[model samples]
Target: MNLLFVASECAPFVKTGGLADVIGAVSKSLATTGVNVRVLIPAYPAVAALVATGKTVMTFDDLFGGRARIVAAQAEGLDMLLLDAPHLYDRAGNIYLGPDGKDWHDNDLRFAALSFAAAQIGLNGLGGWVPDVINAHDWQAGLVPAYLRQDGRPAPPVVMTIHNISFQGVFDGTRLSALGLNADQFTQQGVEYYGKISFLKAGIALSQKITTVSPSYAAELLTPDFGMGLDGLLRERQLDLHGILNGIDLDVWDPETDASIVATYSATKLAGKTKNRAELEARFGLTKSDGPLFCVISRLTSQKGLDMLLDCLPDLLAEGGRLALLGTGEPYLERAFIDASNRYSGTVGTIIGYDEGLSHLMQAGSDAILIPSRFEPCGLTQLYGLRYGTLPVVARTGGLADTVIDANEAALLADCATGIQFAPINGLMFGHAISRTCALFAKPKIWTAMMRRAMRHPVGWDLSAAAYLDVYKSALAP
Candidate 1:
């Protein structure tokens, strides 16, 4: 199988969130299946610098108002095609945001150029390499299918994967001609969404197959609450939608061999965890607690339900549970967590920005990882928590509900409890879940058993890669 991944980011070269991790891991995993996989990403300055030895395979005279070229290279253990458009992708610091901390105004045309390139690559092979299938990810590459359709040529089937429905990439319909889109297709059944051109809507409506990160999330997208205004269209295409759960790269996330953490540990040799916990405490300035040391490694955003964490802090502190949070997003939430750290001092610790090494240490040391998301599509942290024996206490929504086997009495009795889950996301329920975790932590035997079980849980990408292969084979059948 020849697979081409069209996306905005890929890990170890470029990453802002879990999507990049998924792309990097999935491409590697699929490669092991004897499938030829190549990912196309914008050549950011840093990324382009790494692939300096690459060979140019394709060029364009005018791509969305710029001269551009595609550089093909095998770098960082993956095959990548770098779209080196200096006018579109040569920005420093952040790829999506400008110096003012706002989205780049030309993101529409920038990504449209990316989609156009992907469509062209699919339609015409690059140096004896033609993709049999194109997998488009997120709103950034959402126009891949749309472009492929506009060509009216027999092109490879495109699979559209929605990482998060919240970001639909809605832009003005007036740019239809400028984006090289057929204005005649601007109908409710086409790319038009709420009188605007939605890149995501075009992919969802035109793609041969649609998938989300988790099965629970796949099912959730059919309803009004989780659909984010696309439920009707999703319902119309339900037959073509599939929910394939995401898996992490175990080699990168293994607790026993991770050099990022202070002390290595496994399910059997858990003593090293204590040392890591001590180091974590010293780093976070947290006092050693008899209760659980819970950590939150997520953005300080309302979507993450961190405000509720603020409301639930007293309950957690009263129960002797300490907190160490490391992430940055939303000014108000950042100030709140920073202020909480100040007011609570030894019991609470907060770092405004994210550090990759510190995140590994936090996972290795924390007894539990709290993820109280309002709605999570597929959370990679919970998977990392499971891999590291850091039990995940999460809301019963989307992938969190799918991944975490809540330590309810039935689950505990069955010896299958992996973490804690609470529904009806609010301060009360979240606080109750924290109390439940504390109660479990109090029982050393039960807590240890749960930790071992969590560590034993399979979180790697092998199974998901196989599932994707099946999707490709079926899409190509007949």
Candidate 2:
């Protein structure tokens, strides 16, 4: 099967979240399975340097508005087609952020150009190779299905995966024409979301099939709270909706193979894990304690339960613990963490920035990892942490609930167990769970057993790709 992925970002080339990771890993995995997978993403200024020269494909015009060109490239051995829209993409900073320090007010216009470009690519064919299925990720690529359906283009069937339904692209309904959307599309049954145009809704309403990142998330979208106001539409299309759990790139996360970590260890031998913990302590100028070291590497956003984590910090630190955080978002949350670091000095260290190497090291070094999201669509960090032998303490929501199992339960049934799962997302509960993890880590035998269990568990992309292949076949079937 020939598949073309349209997403806002792709890993290594560009990334802000798990969407990029899925796009890059899944494309490569599908290719390995004998599928010709091509990717189309914006060539943002921050990532343009990563694409090697002489890979520029021919230029083309946007199907909706503006002129655009595609630069051909390969990332981690996967063929890629970059949509080069300098006027829309070549900004001074992150793809979503401008140098002026705010999201460009014309985000709809920019991504609309991307969506139109993707439709044109499928319609015109790539070097006489039209995609069997054009799969889109998140709301940015949601427009692909909308354009294909509304523009009356003879395009291949489209499948849009909702990584997180909460971020439905709700713009002013009046801007439908400017977005190249027909006014008719602004009806109660179309892109309109409570008087606004929702990009994700358009995709779900028009695509051949709708898929979320995880099965648990797939079920959650039927509810009012997690649905982000599209539960009814999703319930209407429940038969067409699916929840496909994401897989991590094991090659990039294996401690033995990874070079970013201070030390390496395997399931059979965990001496290096101890060395890594000490190294992490020293790097962060933290004190050596027998209590488990819990690390949180995520953007300080409310969606990620930053407030809840902050509320639990004092109690966690008071109970003989340490934290090493690496991420940037939500200034108040950042400062709150910084304030905690100031008060607890050696017990807590916060780095308000993103460093891939540091993240890998955190996974390698921490005895336990923390992820307490209010509603996670699918979390890649916990998967990475589990693979690295850092038992994850994640909330029972979305993929986190599906992936991580309680430590005691995991040991009772080693064959089907992985990490820790907490329910009733609250600060007190989060602290209690941290306390439990610390108690388990205090015992070497139990902690070692848990690490071995986590390492043995598998969450690779092959299984996920196979499931997606089934969906792709269904989309293209006569």
Candidate 3:
């Protein structure tokens, strides 16, 4: 059970989104299950820092028309291989973006180098350590499968996981020559997507199996709404697609042992949660109160339905509830939340950036977490909210539809509900959901029962990892 994971980012070493967390946690979990899992990522500045502590396992002179090497290291308790191509990955800014707040102009070449190196390693073993399966993640490493197929050699089975369909890594068709891709590979059934070369499309077309983050999302992607223009191709390969719901790293996310929060508390002993609530209020410059407090920790993007939440803010405040938001995206949305905080000085507070520690404290302190995403693949915040006993108010879509048992009349009566879920994903529906949560909060006994159920929920990676193992085995079949 030897596996190689190729991705642009990974947690603890470098990260820009939930993809990193998934790769990090899932790889570590798989390794524990007797699978020899090794992750390969570009040697970004943050990753390059590890070279001092790591060793150069292999070097290559014929990759991306430049010198590249594979440096072995340890990250997040998993074996890591850094594709050290300084010319392509030595930039100082974010992984995909430049300091000027735009995507790097040479991003196609940068990630192409990464994929080429991965393909090389998959075809030819690195230091006699060939992987039985190659799993490429997101559009960043989407070229791996394509390159492997183009090599026309015996290679390990390749699997591509689409973390987000929005970013397809589209580039001019003329750039194909730079990547050493044959012109014949560019076609409607190949990588050509509307006269452009689509990295994600290539992976989806050439890979033996494809997977998304959640079951609902996998189904959603076959339709035009969530497909981002590749729905037809995805439908053609629907049988080979899977939706494995992602899980959080329990050891890193558990509230009982988390060092980030102001106090540690479990479902039975909730006194520490009260202390954390007060601390959170003070930290956010909000007046302490007994009203239900809701927290939002997500990218302030339209996809996340933040505008809908903003539209319902006044109604939520009128219900005698408080809100705390932490995130940064879409400058206008950031300003909108800040303006809302100013308008409702005491009832609303916002931090216009991301902080891991602050996010944990918010999860621990808030009575409910707000996740009104219109089409989430598999939200990690809602999962974290469930783990911390902070009921999530998520839209009924994607993983939210799969993981959360909506706190309706039947579920509540059965004592199996974990959180609140609403449909339509609009301002009015979100407002109603918030009102429902506030009413639930008024009943301490019922709310506590729901919290207990949420705390007891299984959000670990064991089940999801086993499903991935099945996918890997299936890919290797025949």
lDDT per model, in order? Answer: 0.93, 0.84, 0.91
Overall local distance difference test of candidate 2: 0.84
**Considering lDDT, which of the candidate structures 1 and 2 is the better prediction for this target?**
1
Can you give the lDDT of residue 72 in candidate 2? 79
Name the TM-score of candidate 1. Answer: 0.99
- lDDT tens digits by residue: candidate 3, 1-478: 9899999998978887799899999999998889999999988889766876888888988666678899999855889999888888888867888888899988898888888888988988878899999999988888887888788999998899999999999999989888789888888867788899999999999899999999999999999999989999999999999999999999999889999998999988888888889989998888877779999999899999999988888889888899999999999999999999998897899999888889999999999999999899998998999999999999999999999999999998888999999998788999999999999999999999999899989999999999999999999999
Model 2 residue 80 CA deviation (Å) reads: 1.0
- lDDT per residue for candidate 1 within 190-242, as digits (tens), equals 78988899999999998888989999999999999999999899999998898
TM-scores of the candidates are 0.99, 0.96, 0.98
Candidate 3 all-Cα RMSD: 1.1
Model 2 C-alpha lDDT per residue in residues 1-478, reported as the tens digit of each score? 8889999998877888788888888888888889999888888875566544636565866533557678877657877788777778877767887777577888988888778878877877867788889998888987887777777867899898999887887788888988988877787767787888888888888889888899999999999999978899999999989889999887777899889977789999888888888888887878998777989899889999978988788788777878998889899998998988898899999889898888988898998889999999999999998888899999999999888877665455554446677779888778778888877777777778778888887878988889999999888887
Backbone steric clashes in candidate 2, count: 0
Q: How accurate is candidate 3 locally (lDDT)?
A: 0.91
Worst 10 residues of 1 by lDDT: 44-53
